[model samples]
Target: MKLRPLLITASRWKQIQQPLYPWVVTVDRIMRHERLGNMPGPLVHLFSDYGGAHKESLYETTAVLYMDVDNSMPWQVERLRVRQHFLPDGRRMSFKGLNDVKKQQALIPFLQASDSIPGVLLVAAVHKSIKNLCWSKDVRPDWPSDRAMRHKWSPRTFERALHVSHLAGLMVGGLSNPGQEVFWFSDEDELFANPTASNDVGNLFTMFTSVYANHPFKQIGLGTTAIDEGDRYEEDHVALADLAAGSAADMLTELAKYAGHIPTKVAIEFPGEFSRKTEIITSWLGYSGGNLKKVMVVLEPQGKTGFSVMRLNW
Candidate 1:
C-alpha cells in the first residue's frame, strides 16, 4: 500500500527543532535506504519483512501501544494473549505440517467488537544517523573496524538503538500507568509494570551515550547523567513505542521528498511531563472508549525554505 501523505503547514514546519533534526535526517536516511539498502542489516531485515501483502500487518504490529488492563479481568488477559500471539488481522495458525500451517483469519474485528480493553498508546520515531555518528565519534573506540561497516551492527549499535526506542516507549508508558500493578508495554506484551522500571530507565544511558542521550536531559536542564530506565521493547507497550518510532520515521521519509533537505531526526512523541495540558486522548475504535490517543508533533529545519508532509495511521 502507498504511504499516507503528510501536508506539513508552515506552523508544523516551525515545530521542528535542532534536537529533533537528527531524527528527521535519520528518517530520510532510512527512507533512502528503502531504495538504496544501506541501513544496518537487522533494521533492513525488518523493513524488508513488511512488503506487499504484509505491509499493513507490519503497520499494525509495529505500531506499539501502551495498554492498561484490569489485573483481575480474566477475559481481558485472554483477549490480550490472543492479540499478542496472533497477527493483528487475526490470522491464527495451527501448524499441521513443518512448512504449512492452517490459517485462521478474521479474529481481531470480532474480538474488538465484542470486548475491547482500554489503554493508552504512546510512540515516537527518530533518525539514527545522528546517534550513529555520535556513537562512532564519542563512544565507538574503533570506528573503522566496527561490525556496522559490514552491515552487521555491533551489539552496542543494536543496544543503542534498542535503548533509545525503549526509552521513548517508557516515557510514553509513564503517562498511562496511573494506578495499576501491571501495565502492558508494547504490542508484544512481553514487558510490564514492575520494579525493573528504574533499571529500564538506567539502561538507556548506559547503552548509548550519544548526544541524544544527554540531549533529553539537556533539554530539561538536567545536567546529571544518571537515569532510571524502563522495560525492554519486547513488551507490548514498547512495541507501540516502536510502532510510533517507526511510524514517525516512515512519515519523515516521505516528508523528505518535498523538503529538499535531509533532516537529522524527526521525533513524534506525546507531550512529556511538562506539556500535560496538550496531551489529548480520543476513542480510536468508535464507541469502545479505548484509552487510545494520537500525538502528532511536526518540525522542520531551523532555517529551511520548503515544506512537505507524510501521514502514519494506526
Candidate 2:
C-alpha cells in the first residue's frame, strides 16, 4: 500500500474523539459495489485484535474487521478450505504460525479470493509515549467517586477497553443499519480475562454506541473467547485483524527510526532489514481489487501536546 496525508471530515472525527485518547484518527473505506443502505437487514460482525502493547514498542496498534452476516457462511467455508489446503492435519492459521515463505505464500490465494465477501479492515495506531498522558483528567472526569472505586482498572486495561469501545462506536456509526443486530468477537486478551472488566467494557461499548454512534440497532452482543475454543471461522476473522495489527505496529516502529519528522504524503519505504514476515505484511498491505477494503489511520504526535492524522493507501 501507499502512504498519503488524509483529511478526516469534522463531524465524523468529532464522534471518534469520544474516547478522549488525545491522539486518535479514523479511516474508513467501502469497496463493495452495492451501497450499504441497499443491503437487507445488514447484521454486522466485528472481530478485533491488538498488537505491540509491550513496553519496548513505541506504538500500539488495534485492528477491527467488519463483515456482514449475509456473507458469513460463504466466507467461513472459503477460509476453512484455505486452512485445510495449508494444514491438512487441521491446525489453525495465525500470524505467528506463518513462519516461513511457503506458509506465507499460502495466504495470498485466500486473500485474493476473499474479494467476494464484503468486509472492511480498520486500524488505529497510537504513540505509546502519549497514550496515558492525562488519562483520569480527560476520560469521564466526572465519574462518581463511588462508581470509580467500584470499577477500578489499571491504566493499561483502561486504555485497551477504551480502544475497543471507540472502534465499536466507529463501526456502528459508520456501518450499521436501523434495527440491525451487531455482534463483536475478540481474541482472548487480558482486558477481557476478568469477568468484571469484560462486563464493564461491554456496558461502556453499549453506552458509547447509543450516545456517540447514534445508530439504532436491535441488539448488540460482545464475546471474548480463546482461539481454540471459539468458532474456527470467526477466529479466522480475528486472525486477519491480528496479522494487520502486528504488521501495522511493526511498520510504524520501523518508520519512526527514519521518519525524523513525519511528512505529509510520502510513500512507505522500509530501508532496514526486511524479514519473511515483513515481506508477507507488505504484500498484504498492497492487496487491492476486492470487496475487502483496508484503511490505516496513523495518529502521530506533532508536539508534546498534539498529533497528526494521516491515511495510508494502497
Relative to the true structure, candidate 1 reaches a TM of: 0.35
What are the Cα lDDT values of the candidates?
Answer: 0.29, 0.66
Which 10-residue window of candidate 1 scores lowest in summed lDDT?
43-52
- Top-TM-score candidate index: 2
Q: Give the Cα error of residue 308 in candidate 1, in Å.
A: 15
Query: How accurate locally is residue 130 in candidate 1, as Cα lDDT from 0 to 100?
Result: 25
Q: Considering every candidate listed, which one attains the maximal lDDT?
A: 2
Count of steric clashes across candidates, in order = 45, 0
Model 2 worst lDDT run, 10 consecutive residues: 30-39
Stretches of candidate 2 off by over 4 Å are: 5-41, 100-105, 133-136, 143-151, 227-231, 265-269
Report how far off residue 4 is in candidate 2 (Å): 3.1
Write down the TM-score for model 2: 0.82
What lDDT would candidate 2 get against the real structure?
0.66
